[model samples]
Target chain A: MIDVQHLTKRYGRVTAVDDVSFRVEKGEILGFLGPNGAGKTTTMRVLTGYMPPTEGRALVAGHDILEAPLEAKRRTGYLPETPPLYPEMTVRDYLMFVATINGLASAERRRRVETAMERTRVADMASRHCGKLSKGYRQRVGLAQAILHNPDVLILDEPTAGLDPKQIHETRDLIKSLGGDHTVILSTHILPEVAQTCSRVVIINKGRVVAIDTPENLTARLRGAETMFVQVDSAGADATPVIAAVPGVTGVTIAARRDEQASYEVASERGHDIRRQLAAAIVTQGWGLLELRPLRMSLEEIFLQLTTEENAGGAEVPRA
Target chain B: MRNVLAIARRELRSSFASPVAYVAVGLFALVFGYFFYATLVFFAERSLQATQFGMGGPMNVNQMMIRPLMLNVSVIVLFFLPMLTMRAFAEEKRSGTFELLLTRPLTDWQIVTGKFLGAMAMYSLMLLVSLVSILLLFLLGNPEWRQVATSYLGLLLMGGCFVALGLFFSSLTRSQLVAGVLTFSALLLLWVINWTADSAGPVMRAVVQALSITDHFDDFSRGVVDTRHLVYYLSFIGFGLFLTARAIDSERWKG
Candidate 1:
């Protein structure tokens, strides 16, 4: 469990994190979404006790990060933006060193290192030098080092940043498996990763928390226009007029066809999915209906809307 | 303590893995070996029966042992200590491993002391290799083993001081090159401070000589165990370790 209250981090004339506050419940996987330079790494560093907040306080597992740093840090494992790795050491050596630093006993240190290596699928690369490994392997090695001691909290900053698509998926699965056992705060700009891996999402923009909720809830809350994608095999046929004849149809915008079938994006009032009626209308018009599906707003759209609104609101502050 | 040992073992292995450490040892052997043999050949030529090398040239036995074994060892250590200590925190910061270290349960002092001892261990290893010429003195003839032992003790103390200064400079910045240069410059300044103080009169000379690391080495080099000199070397080491701990603490707030 973690609690951050009125947190702020300033660097000289610039403020990196500005009075941001959020809580992560026990066993919850919270995805931190933000654009570049949105203070995601700074906030993660503060939470893991790598750095102290300029203002306010952060508590990890009921211990203050500033006052009881060792206790707070004991419960947290952090993977920085770039995997902090010593090039000269082998994977096993590095993980063992980290395990010892985390205060594991001799036997437990070996067990933890083996367990972490197995979990991150880096067991085979144990004997290889870290610098000689591939980027994906290096990232996994970083993950192994962070989780070697099996801390209660894990703060991973851009965990899958440099990985290829396959490696990213593997990293996502690794992170997802960590949920419910260890509270995780995953900071990344990848939208789909939040949708796929996190139980709740926290969107930060310009050093502020813009929104925090389930991915589904955020999309649902931002839902405004209801549109349906309909593909019909009717080029010359008047499909729009036929669809308008159905119930709840307000307007239809025809989209470019892919093959020879005409596609249309139909807009209707809220709580309206007239697929059956529209099918009957298409049947009556003797036109072939290929596909019909209701479209929902995506996470990307919600993110853009939230961040843009915040930027605009920031500009309006001086005007007011 | 376990963390410190773990770091020490890893750092020691890393030193062997790199060419820099080996090169440092080789360079030390070359310079120190030459100076040691030169002292012995000169002593043999003069047929001096004295047991100790006296201070300064025109070569007393005390000067022979101290200048070659003690002074030259410090000079060799001066060249290599920075190279070892430069990687202490600066390399970690550049590579982002410092963040990983902080997120763990260890305190700032634990990390700093662990790294300090680690670097010191490597330096000691290099110093041990330079002992070869001292051992070779036994083969040439019956040399005063007591004088040899005391000279070694002096070399160890001086080496410790240099390692401490190097570690402090290493913590002051994140650039290894800058750390190396600053360490070299600081040690060089200390070496010349006594000379500068002599020009400024008796009071200044007394202060500067007391502060001079080599000046303290003279006690041990003469087979004399001065408690004040021992304390000075220790205080130098403690001060550097203390500042290193504070530097690490400051980084947390700055970050």
Candidate 2:
């Protein structure tokens, strides 16, 4: 429901968002992953109609963000990096005010506020002033504000930036549930959050989109070979040769060892399934197999690899 | 219009939630009360002399009392009313609510008008306190209610001008203190712009005198609803609000 075409934003001498283009389908959760100051917020700002792009444009729900801002804004909900909360207003009143400004009918405003609060799990703090709320509550209230209008597109910047592990988990679940009905585009520097919640990841670096694909594709494509970690209690006897002698094993290297236990990272041929062969080899050698698990390349490693590789190999510096 | 009212209501509600509204209104009422007492004493002394010596007929309380009292209020409006509008846009920017406001479906005109309405409401509260002193006059003597009403209209229009100008400065910066200072300076310049007329050339004199904000307010306080002054004040308010809208639009580009 969102189409961005070569959107570029510049602040005088500095280009915050370069010529970047991406499209998000209806009900898809697109994760915008980038390091801090990597122009994620700037890109989101242009998309949400908060600021117009210096060059090119974006369309939200078929309305050009620059030409038909009101229509576009009406269908999109935005939660900025810092949750916009009036510290003096209670959560209920604040949500009500947001509903009114967003042009919700008077008859429907109250119900929408309650539903939004319930969905974000901030209903208990309805009467409490936002200033007194904890960081986690403030963030949830912000989330509630975005969904209160029942907008088609939700733009959240660092939605889970500050929170306990449990709160983060709850927030991720909430965002995951928000999909299918709302096309969500969330930006974060946290790799796991993107991998866990977003259906598609857009890895950005230095104000440019270096990679965009599904989480599975990003990790699997970067691996190039199937690797496994095997730990064996060989009684201090080396098991590298035994693992290396397995039929599909191409290479074996000892990762760690202590006393009678040892760990080896075994590289296997592509499209190979050698778990049974490696197990038989270890058992026949009288080595006790402690642990054997496939080690897929994680999103973190892929993110690092993609972002770091962008400016390498004589990539030119961008100028305004 | 609904969106405008909603934003206006929030602006007024937030002002009262903080101490800014109370302190400004309280200071205004205190100064107004002191002026009312002094002017009443002066009128009482003049009436005593008229009756004792049989010098003339009874005094017109509205002319003698309420007129100068409102003039004093118009002067103080230059000082206190700017505070009402100083945080209209500055605080929103400082607290990051500006993003929420801009991204909403509402137009810049709606937000600016809402802020103006909220600040005018606060200005109205300040004017309402003068009612306490005006109502007391009815307890003992009859004041011309028409004159009283006209004086209020005068103060309202004058304060509206200040409120609009203050909103313009507030939208230009993210600092309330800076907004307040700039508003005060601008009002003071407009106040004294006429002062230069006395020594200026003939053409310069008429322009400066007509451009002075206080000169437009003089007709309203004397119970004269001159359309010229009405148009001037209305246009002044409209232009200030127009500039404020442009400021926000430009801010979006700057960001």
Candidate 3:
């Protein structure tokens, strides 16, 4: 439901968002991952019709963001980096105001506001002023406003930036529940959030979309070899030589030792299952196998590898 | 129009929710009451002097009291209008609500008009407070009601222009203090522009004098509702609001 084509935004001498392009299908939760100052917020801002891009165009629900801003804006709800709130207004009044401005009918406005408040769990604080609420409540109130109108597209920037761990978990669950109905584009520097909540991830670095894929696919593609951590009771007999002697074993390195047990990180060729052969070899050497587990790359590792590796190679390739 | 009203309603509600509206209106009433009392005393003293000299004619309260009070209120608004409008766009930008406002389906003109009307609504309340003092004159004295109404019209129009100008300045900055200071300076400059008329040549003098906001207001305060003066105030308001609309439009590009 969202299409961005070669969108570029420049602030005088500095280009905040370079020529970047991406598309998000209906009901897709696209995680916008980037380091600080990676233009994630800028891209979302352009798509929300908050600011026009310096070059190219963006479409929301089949309407041009620049040419038909009102139509585009009508179908999109945006929660900026900092929640856009009026400190003087109560949570109820603020949401009602948002509902009114969003052009909801009077009869529908009250129901929508109540539903939003209930969903975000701000119903108890509805009468309390926004300024008096804690950071987590404020964030929830912000989410309520964005989802009140039930727009077709939702663009959130750092939705869980200042929340505590529990709040973050609740927010991620809320966002996950919002999928399959509202097309979501959320930006964050948090890697696990993408893995847990988003269906697809777009990793941007230095104002460019360096990598875009599912979290699982990204980790799978980046892992050139399968790795496993194995701990054994060496009994004064080293197991590295025996494990490395297996047919598919690529390499092995001593990891750590506890009492008489030593851990070895074993590497094998991709798509190879060397655990059976390696276990047989260890048994033949009279070494007791204590623990054996495959080491899958975490989203953190995949993110770091993708972002830093691109920077190291100085690749600024413009997406076609 | 519905969107405009919604925005205006929200703005008005938020204004009253804070101390800014109360403080501004309270200060206005205090200053206006003091000026009204001072001007009434001076008119009474002058009338008494005329009676003692056996040259007393009928005392025209509209001419002696209402006219001067209206002018005084205009001057008071020159200082207080910025307080009403400085937060119009400045606070929104500071608190990041400007993004929320612009990202909505409402147009720039709707936002500008809504904010302008909201500020004007508060200003009207300030004027209404002064009306209580004016009503007392009608009850106790035989002031010409037509002239009193005309003076109020003049105040309203002048206040509209002031609000428009203030809103324009507010849109240009994120600092409310800077917006207020800049608006006050701009109004003061316009208020004193007529002072330079004497030093300039005849043609230049006319241009400078015409630009003075108070000069156009003088006709309405005198119970003379000339279309020319009405046109001038309307044009002034239009120009100010037009500039404010343009200022907001530029924000889209600058962002």
Q: DockQ winner among the candidates? A: 3
> Model 2: runs farther than 4 Å from truth?
A234-250, A280-285, A311-320, B50-60
Better of 1 and 2 by DockQ: 2
Candidate 1 wrongly placed segments (more than 4 Å) = A233-247, A257-261, A311-320, B48-60, B66-68
Q: List model 2 lDDT by residue over A52-126, tens digit each.
A: 999988999999999999999999999999999999999999999999999999999999999999989999999
Q: Can you list each candidate's DockQ?
A: 0.78, 0.88, 0.88
Please state the i-RMS of candidate 2: 0.5
Residues A88-148, candidate 1, lDDT per residue (tens digit)?
9899988888888888888788888999999999999999999999989998999988788
- What order do candidates take by TM-score, descending? 3, 2, 1
In angstroms and one decimal each, the interface RMSD of every candidate reads 1.1, 0.5, 0.8
For candidate 3, write residues B1-255 as lDDT tens digits: 888888888888888999988998888889988998999899989999888885768777887888888877778889888899999999999999999999999888899999988998899899998788888888888888898889889989998999999999999999999999999999999999999999999999999988998888887888989998899889989999999999988888888
Runs in model 3 lying further than 4 Å from the true structure: A311-320, B56-58
lDDT of 2 at B156: 92
Docking class of 3: high
A293, model 2: CA deviation in Å? Answer: 2.2
> What DockQ does candidate 1 score?
0.78
